[model samples]
Target: MSKETLTIEVSWPASLAVPEGSTIDIQLWAGNDKAGYSMIDGDFSTPATASPVTLEIPYDSQDLQSHDGTTTWDHFHTSPRLVHGGFIKNIAYAEKISVAQTKGAAWKMALR
Candidate 1:
């Protein structure tokens, strides 16, 4: 499989509540499931806006798969081939957000 650098820019809604100088963990999941192939995580000055992270990803036919009658795919495998057809798609997720503790302030998170 041919290899290339994949750059992804991640950001959050401006209306969302985010603490300044908090650490954010971003994960890149490929294919049809939650098994992530690559990840980039660090502490940034602003949690709402993050710099683009790059992943050395496989491309071309070896980067793709087809679910014919007998073809099988497993998430635990380390192969970069995640797409099930002729196209490539991926999912980006933000996780493990660390909030800075403030003196005399109460922290509350609303779940949707």
Candidate 2:
């Protein structure tokens, strides 16, 4: 089996209220499987006011399984002393491969 790296980007809504100096916990699950889990704990710091925030999370492709060329991913967020809940709807993960061909070469390699 080969390993691939995937980066998950999440855009946070500006309307969500977040306390200053508080940390936001982010969790990623592959489908409904509990074994396919990845977490970014306390990695996000809430600003003084709500604003659009983007988070870039990296994961191994082996950690997630795709069906029909698409994989279902779920994200959750919470703060200290707050109940953990889903932050957004289901996210679809598709495998994207880019290949570059060089001169004098009859073939190219797929890069993911």
Candidate 3:
């Protein structure tokens, strides 16, 4: 089953903090369709003058796979907290994704 095009903006109070030299490992979604996404395209970098800066990622993709059968990554990042991801673009598609909180963390799966 598909979910409604979802947009989630999760915020933490200034009191809540991440250690220095740490990046908020998060998944960014790009469209509205509950079709669990796999390959996504985006970028993250250490912000200049960084001080607990929240990175706002605006994304949009259509091909999202679900977890009914589980998925594997072709390549992965060194950071254990950083999950594996991938993607492709062309033709046309939808726009909203939902964030599923998993493993004491959050995985933003594009329901497209």
Best by lDDT: 2
The sequence of per-residue lDDT tens digits that candidate 3 reaches over residues 1-112 is 3322222223333443334444334444322344423544555433212333334444322223334434422211111121222212111123232343221233232211
| Cα TM-score per model | 0.29, 0.34, 0.30
Model 3's lDDT to the true fold?
Answer: 0.30
Model 3, residue 35: displacement in angstroms? Answer: 4.4
- The lDDT, on a scale of 0 to 1, for candidate 2 is 0.32
Q: lDDT at 31 for candidate 1?
A: 35
Candidate 1 segments exceeding 4 Å error: 32-112
Model 3 TM-score relative to the real fold: 0.30
Residue runs of model 2 more than 4 Å from their true location after superposition: 1-17, 32-50, 65-112
RMSD of each: 16.7, 12.6, 13.3
Q: Which ten residues in a row have the lowest lDDT in candidate 1?
A: 73-82
Cα lDDT tens digits, model 2, 1-112, are 3343323232334544444543333444444323333333224322222233333444444444445536543422221221124342222232222211111222111111
**lDDT by candidate, in order shown:** 0.28, 0.32, 0.30
Model 3 per-residue lDDT at 54: 38
Candidate 1 on 14-94: residue-level lDDT in tens? 444444443333232223244434222222211322333222322332332333423222221121211223332222322
